[model samples]
Target: MESNSSLGTALLPEESTETSFWRKVLDVEEVKKQVLFSLPMILTNAFYYAITLVSVMFAGHLGELELAGATLANSWATVSGFAFMIGLSGALETLCGQGFGAKTYRVLGIYLQASCIISCFFSVIISIIWFYTEPILILLHQEPQIAKKADLYMKYLIPAVFAFGFVQNVLRFLQTQSILMPLVLFSGLPFALHFGIVYTLVHWTGLGFKGASLASSISLWISLILLATYVVCSKKFEHTWGGFSSESFRHIVTNLRLSLPSAAMVCLEYWAFEILVLLAGLMPDAAITTSVIAMCVNTEAIAFNFTYGLSAAASTRVSNELGAENPGRAKTAMAVALKLVVLLALVLVLALVFGHNIWAGFFSDSTLIIKGFASMTPLLAISISVDSFQGVLSGVARGCGWQHLVVVANLVTFYGIGMPIAVLLGFKFKLYAKGLWIGLICGLSSQAATLLLITFRTRWTRIDLSAEREQGTLDSV
Candidate 1:
């Protein structure tokens, strides 16, 4: 009987041809696992993003001037404050992720504290800049009235920066441990509540435009409080979240080494999109060009946010596997992530291809703007495809603690190669909006290619963070 059972088990593959073929091609289970992991993260990120956008929407209905001011303020907040905060927290993806894997559990809390400290320090600096936004905008040749309105919106938005930083850092701390479902709840709840808060302030309380910015501040803090409470109270983190210690202050310098480069890696890419919008303002049909380019930027941001979940998953998987001293498994994990990215990108590109006009209509009623977006749809598709590849790769880089190398890649590719061609084609060659997007596509392709090379040529190894902890530096990498 035992021999017959063994014989039947051995012959199972012959009966299931599809399963055998997939087994030969890829790890079907791992792909499914990543897809499941990515969904919650996608929802969490989208929810957090919607909190601010919803505020802008509420304020936009007040008046055209209100809309203009609120939009500019929101964009400025993202570039100078929110993007930098998100980047600074990226260090924890490496530190906390690997530490959890290596069973150096207590170190995760210490690193989280250190990252939060760093965020607070930078938020102060950025707040000072936000305070003087009126002068800065005027200096940059913005209309004085619009600049003043932006300045008003920014001042009220300042408190949100500190909250945003803490929220992001805590997110990384939890994300690294695969504590994800709570994130969707915590982030989604605040975002849902934010709509009511903005409405009350904008309409019921009579704060007007200032209320929209202030509402974002309140909602972000709500998110932080919920997340902080969970991290503090949950038994799931008992091994990792030791109560705060003075020791974290000592690790600030170590966190900064990676955090600074991570911040630059994010900021460079973000600034490039804003720069394109600014250049559009200089075009012959500045109104139409600026509107279309801004829409494109927003469209790209939305797509990236959608893929960001997979990127986060890739980072966590690679870092955790590496920390477990399984380099081959880490490589296989990244391969699976890339495959998923390709599949997801194709779906997104197809959606954009078939529904380009419908998507554009949401942003504007102007036929000219809609037509312009339709014309740029093909280039946008290519860029989105490449951007998806790079997003996962960038997450892998964060996991590998290679932000320094990635930053240099971003600087050289986006600033050195991408921007020069954009200028030449945009102004010199007369391509205008299409030319600007084409230049951006060039940058995205170059960046994706560079990151791909780095991932392949570089060694995959875990940082001995325990050793670094004892040595007082992260140089052990």
Candidate 2:
């Protein structure tokens, strides 16, 4: 009798036999497992972004200047620091996910350590850039007062960058193995703790904006420590983690081959939106436009966490199936993930359409900011829907070791196509924030279409785990 651990191999069967499309799509067992694996991650990501929104809300109430300053600072941190760390850590989604499926469990720990080392090194570079943020913003023609405040906020948040790097590495490490419950527990505790910490420091202690930054940094560190402790003590990780190995140091070049392109792909998408906020700051009512646009971006970011959760699940499923040499099952996982995200996107679009005003009001009581956000809500909804599909496809690409391909696609679609249109319509035509978002929608639509085509045309059987193991590349364990 086959054990439950060997069931994935049964999913392969014989390719000579044909299966109906609907039967593959209606695989209830696979769908159930994917949903169970994805739910905790979705809730955890929602909590993570909610904490960020709460910080932004605290800053928003401090004053218009503080709101704009913190918005710019957070945007910079995301584009320059957090996105890079998350992207770099994503290499593990391929390595560890496949390693687990291939029963090369020890390699998962090695890849996790390698990812942490690289991420910490990058954090130092980002911190230095944060120290000089004021000059950089000024050079970009930002208001001098706002630039100064943004610089201060970034300076206070530097410690959190390193903390966040470890957080992301652990997140990917646990996620690839489908050990998600701890993520929810650990992340939720800090999220609840963050509000009190921010309130006490900001209002009672009179730290104001800096206090908010400090609160967030401290909360992140606490979460990291808790997560680290769990990873260390859990018996489930025993086989995968056999203490820190020097072997981690030897894989720099090999890991970078995936990490760098993954970083670029993520950075391009993230920085594009940050650029939108920066450009909005250059508009006539710089503070108001920046505030409204930032709010819209924040709202969209929360929605993104949902799709991102699905993306992670898709990556894990596809990579695991491919590693187990079940190409048919891998393709089925891709189909089911795409279907799920599209349904989620549709539900989100309706909510945004009907509840735009109420949602905007949560961020600010200012009528002007709320009104501005309302005008752009439709565009935001459309962009989110398009981005939902693209996010899942990118995950598929990562699972299939196509990060380098997607980097090129992102560059051409976002930078080559989207950025120019955004600038031309936004500044040249003076359409401002709305125009910038419209241009972004165009770019996202292009990326989604291209990735879908690529996914469809992929020769799944040719994606061999044996070849990867032989080359000592991704599956080197």
**TM-score of structure candidate 1:** 0.92
The residue pairs in collision within model 1 are none
Alpha-carbon local distance difference test for all models? 0.85, 0.85
RMSD, every candidate, angstroms:
3.2, 6.2
Question: Residue 105 in model 1: shift from native, Å?
Answer: 0.2
lDDT, candidate 2, residue 465?
53
Stretch of 10 with least lDDT, candidate 2: 14-23
TM-score, every prediction: 0.92, 0.93
Tens digit of lDDT per residue, candidate 1, span 1-477?
A: 999999999988887987888876777877877888899999988888888878876776676566556666777788888999999999999888877777778888899999999999999999999999999877766556766888999999999999999999999998999888999999999998998899999999968889999999999999999999999999998888888889899889889988999999999998887788767767776556766777787788878888899999999888888777777777888999898899889999999999999987765666887899999999999999999999999998888778999999999999988888888899999999888888888898999999999999976654443325556443222
Residue-level lDDT of model 2, residues 1-477, one tens digit each, is 468657756665643233555455567667787788778988888877676668877877888788889888888778788888888987888877877788788888888888888988889998899889999999999999999998988887899889988998899889988999999999999999999999998999867888878887888898999999999999989998888889988876667777888888899899888888898888999988988888877877888898888898889998888778888998888888888888899988999999989987776778988899988988998999999999999998888778888998898899888989999999898889888998999889888888988888878888855325856654546
